[model samples]
Target: LTVTMRQRPSFVVVGEVRGAEAFTVFQAMSIGRYVFATFHADDIETFIHRMESKPINIPRNLMLTLDVVIILSNLSSDRGSLRRIKTVSEITGQDQLTSEIVVNNAFTWNSVTDTNPYSGFSYVLKRIAEKEGKFEADLEKEVDIRSKILDKMIEKQITNYKEFYNLVNLFYKDRVRLFETLDMTEEVLM
Candidate 1:
């Protein structure tokens, strides 16, 4: 896979580089290909701390593979405004240690204080409910159930990695055809 990518460089977006995929991802980036990837890095310290922790398991040899490390924070600004970003970072693997990554603040977002009664997160689900299809109602029901479950989870304390991992592994029922059915991809991971 790495050789094939090197032979034909292409833009790749990885959802998360949490496991052994980190090695190949690093090699591909080092070899020159436009790659945009994000792990659970919320801050530089968090990123550094995490690289030194488990689940990330980034090999020491492949540590400085990224050309950029964009950090996202959900912190509210001092001005009582919510902040979101399409931030940018330039990764320099020059110095081994004591090298601080540079971040360029590209954009900021305003907070939504008042609720517009017309808005909700279940728009897609609502549309699916209205649509006439074999699993249309099932999709809507699933979305609603998921939303409720997520809300309940959010109300509770932080979820452990094992719990989330179990959820992911369990949710991926018949993943072999899930992608093909969505017309996203026909290839199976395994």
Candidate 2:
């Protein structure tokens, strides 16, 4: 799998990260390739700790290339058992001590307050702004537009996976058509 991916793959997806192959996954990310893999850990802290220990031992420098780490947990609330994202951590880089990776507090879900589904600034957004040569506020506006698109999808009961993906792609390809189909004004996207 690693050999074929290295040849000329857009991205690589691994079921899980463990053993010797974990290093290869990190290597793939370092060389400007996207690698998505699941790791067994309760949260971001535990996830980072695990990566630095024992058999996996992913390098701190390699860890710097990571974009985001999403922590999902199954919580029991009055509503019922629900699985959701607990926190989202953005990897900024490694600390000067070279002991661990540095992460920015992106967002967290507060079960008690439930004020907003996500709270806090996103480092990934800032990174995206730098990459796209746009101001952070512009990127944030784009995020808002995308959020509105998702909300419209749910409200209109667009539940099928392929359908959702195709719709989003259509929006990217033909903004005016997608906006008209979704009953959203093109100005809203701007």
Candidate 3:
């Protein structure tokens, strides 16, 4: 991780975080580098416990540098097995009195509905809005637009990774042209 950080990359990704390596991951995050790593834990509570305990021992204060945790779960049902995102949680801060990490769950899986539903609040989006000097509503609108584009891609069976990547890049470079090619209108973004 130290060697890679020297390159000053925009973000760092670790396939899996285990043992003392988690310290380096948190250190990278402490320095304002975005870090994406998978840690094996049954749930958010377990994740926090493990990280705070021996082997990992991430300091409570340093934990503030961590932004989000996404949990994926595998479920078996009548329709066979499916892997789905179980939770999307944001680390807001530490409790002032107890010094415990405060997490806000922005999205959670609904097994009954077999869908991930937004919790109607997101500190992460609020932070992004503040950083970008935009209203939270504006960011929400952008999310809606992007969601529509992704849905359109799935509907059209454009599942190839390369194709999806190029199309997403095109959306950033020539949004109007991409919308036209996708038979969509900017009005839909409203």
Task: Give all TM-scores, in the order shown.
Answer: 0.41, 0.86, 0.93
lDDT of 2 by residue, 1-190 (tens): 6786649687988997778888888888888888888888998889988887898998777777789988888888889988877778888776777556777766777777752254447778877789889998887777778878887898899999999999989988997788888898865746
After superposition, candidate 1 runs with Cα above 4 Å error:
1-7, 75-83, 94-190
Mark the regions of model 2 whose C-alpha exceeds 4 Å error after superposition: 113-120, 186-190
User: Which 10 consecutive residues of model 3 have the lowest summed lDDT?
Assistant: 181-190
Residue 65 of model 2 has an lDDT of: 78
> What Cα-based lDDT does every candidate model obtain?
0.52, 0.80, 0.88
For model 3, state the Cα shift of residue 190 in Å.
3.8
Instruction: Name every residue pair that clashes in candidate 2.
Output: none
Q: Tens digits of per-residue lDDT for model 1 on 1-190? A: 4655756668777777677666667777767666777777665657755774676666544555654565665665566754354233433343547454333332222235421121223333444467645365577455554444444444554288776555445446753343343332322221
Best of the candidates, TM-score: 3
Error of 3 at 43 (Å): 1.5
Candidate with more favorable, higher TM-score: 2 or 3:
3
